[model samples]
Target: ISQGIIFVSLLIFLLVGSLNGRQRTFVSDTVENKTVVEKSVTDYLASKFNTMVIPSLYCIVLLIGLPANALALLILITKTKITPSTIFLINLTLADLFFILLLPLKISYHFLGSNWLFGEALCRIYIASFYGSITCSVFLLMSISIDKYFAIVYPMFSRSFRNRSKATFGAIVIWILALFSIFPFLLSQQTLYISDVNITSCHDILPREEQNSYYFHYFLFLVILGFIVPFLVIIFCYISIIWTLSMNARSQFRAKMLSTLVTITFLLCFMPSNVVLVIHYSEFHASNHSDLYVSYMVCLVLSAFNTCIDPFVYYYISDEFRDKVR
Candidate 1:
């Protein structure tokens, strides 16, 4: 698995390097009208960050996350019995797998200095998949926390709730919701020509006019459903679990430690990006491209790192899962 990961990572790096030189002329021609003086400092910094930093980070994620998630899936499938938590995990792994597969296109786009060589349809698909996976992963993590809450706090009631059919149904529902939530992206024209930069960007760097219309609505929807709702649910569940466990002397230590890990994982990997996204969108609506936008993009990249951290975290939390992998 490690070897496969390294090989794919190197191959992607080579592929990105080769494509980087080919798309320069197209990009140069695209931004001919707008001079450097007209571009905001945020835009300049954003362009540089997207080109230099984001692609390299994405490649690193692909290297570590791809195999890690794949191994997690394999272990879940071959070694463990089907349970509610594992079911949720399987779905999460699949979501991450699908999302990472699309990263090469993103990496290529960033590497080529935000020049989108692929047509508009692929751009829409990429946006949809990226956001969909994020939504799915967050929701599933929330589901797992809820599952654990029931298992620990109300063990008797948990038996019925923890059945395979229910877990499968929950997974299906989360996926459908995730996919449906990103439909607005599919409906929009994601690829836009930046006259200033003389390049067509896939998603992130959009024309100003386009940012106000539908993009605002899409991101608002994401903040509410994708981040806020899930954040509240996960927090409430963990808090309740911690409270319940605190009263019980037997499991308190394990519960507190587990809750800490989950909370840390969510706060570290997910919270920063979502918080910045909200702030970034607020500034965006005001037509002010603050440096916060750069911070938002950086946080977004950090969010992707969660895919790699998730499996290890899960392994630590579940003794069955750990034994199965061993």
Candidate 2:
């Protein structure tokens, strides 16, 4: 009976050992499978483009945009009276400042081969601000377009309601709306470590499975309300302005020129990225893979130039702005 008890104990020990060994082996296998399944940034089509083209552009934007936007903000505030026009210009400059201030991290991310050393929280903040600023610009530009439409098309009638107080309120609502639009990104993880490259990418990679549930809808809505709607409104406002102006105003040329510039800025800076991102997230949601992300990244780089271009828009949109410069 004593010998029987010893045998049973030995059998139980062996079974436990075997189970632990199997568990370890399973865990290792799952990790190995994950490594093999996930493609690193090095293998990505945009990887080379990111390391090469993006950093340089970001550097240029940083060098040029930081001071330009700061100066524009100062001028918009101290140089002009706080009219609706000036309020919009101030907010636009603020948006550009918020975006370009984050560019240093972006530049470092690219320069270091897309490795994100800043950790997860910074990554989330970076992406949130990145997109928040973009949406802000789109919305503010639309507000400005509407302001221009009221000022130019119905100047006499608009004077009753378009005051400093209303403009300030509008600006606040737009700011809240723009950042609120990015609330989803703020809630999710934005940084991932790629085993193949031994690098952590900040918002450079999206989880293949996460898009279908929420992101697909978020990006689509963002593009529509944040960009497409604003774009159409801007176009309508500009068309109305051009149509309403009398030829003798010589200011007719200024209106036409400003309209052209605003259209070009929207087309070049905001439209492509918005379009590409919609396609990217949609395709990624459906197929678990996307090919247009490289285009989206490139277009985002173009969007960053909106930082440099916004000051010019201020000059054209506000006569007070032009007067301040002169």
Candidate 3:
């Protein structure tokens, strides 16, 4: 699975590197026409990337992520006793499954050269589900880390708070929060008819002037809450877990290995994309496309690769999951 991820990353880099040469040349020729040039470059690159790379990658993710998560969900649902951690994993699996199931629409849109054959309402639902599931998944991961921290560090104290009912309630709250956060996006006009291209776009184009301000603020809100806070929480929880385990010589090696794996997995799946999103938006507001935009878009899709990684994490790390599978 890790190798598959590395292969995808390398493929993206190679494809982007090839395109960058042409993009730089275009930018150089139109440097005198700054505003027009920036808009043109942004549109050109976005269209190309969205049409060519994104659709194919989404298909790949759909193929691998769908069945893996479905099987994991099946095992957890039918074979496992409900526990807090298992509940969290089940919710995480559900989020990934739901998100990827919606990818076929995205796949169709991109495959049609970034055209939206789907109606506006369906487009809004697509946009909402895509981001909402991602937010829910991240929060669920944070919930898992906190659960682990308590289980390892303060097992007795954790007993009262960590149970299937609380886990279910927490998952419900996360889903509600995720949906509410993206409600504005659903209300906005997500699909745009581009007369020039003779196609309707589903949510990749920049917002109109009237909507731009709201989008800017909303983008910042998502970055801080959806990515940054959860990242910090995961780090804190895992670091505490490692520190507590270090005192027990018998478990020291296990602690170090788990810490390393968790940190690497978390960073590999999310950090690059989230960091690049912040930079991309900063550049967007300045009406400049960062040189990193291509990489940013690539990383954004790469984050969805988490769907492939999460099931493996459950099988290997969660004994309940493993037993259920067995």
Candidate 2 regions exceeding 4 Å error are 1-40, 45-48, 247-249, 285-291
TM-scores, in order shown?
A: 0.83, 0.85, 0.83
Question: What lDDT is obtained when candidate 2 is compared to the true structure?
Answer: 0.75
Q: How far off is residue 82 in model 3, in Å?
A: 1.2
Report how far off residue 12 is in candidate 3 (Å): 20
Off by over 4 Å in 1: 1-37, 41-48, 195-197, 247-250, 285-290
Q: What is the C-alpha lDDT of each candidate?
A: 0.73, 0.75, 0.73
User: Number of backbone collisions per candidate, in order?
Assistant: 3, 0, 0
> Considering every candidate listed, which one attains the maximal TM-score?
2
Per-residue lDDT, model 2, residue 135, is 91
Candidate 3 lDDT tens digits, 1-326 = 32344456446544543432211112211123321334464465357676788878888898899999999999988888888998888999999998888888878887787678979999999989988988899999899888999999999998998888899999999999998988977888776655545667666554335234657678778878987788778777877887888788767666666656665676677767666555544444443443564665577677788888889888656877777777
Off by over 4 Å in 3: 1-49, 208-211, 285-293, 324-326
TM-score between model 2 and native: 0.85
> How much is the lDDT of residue 135 in candidate 3?
89
Residue-level lDDT tens digits of model 2 in 148-263: 99998999999998998999999999999987998898899777666766877676665545544557688879878987788779888987887788564786777778788888
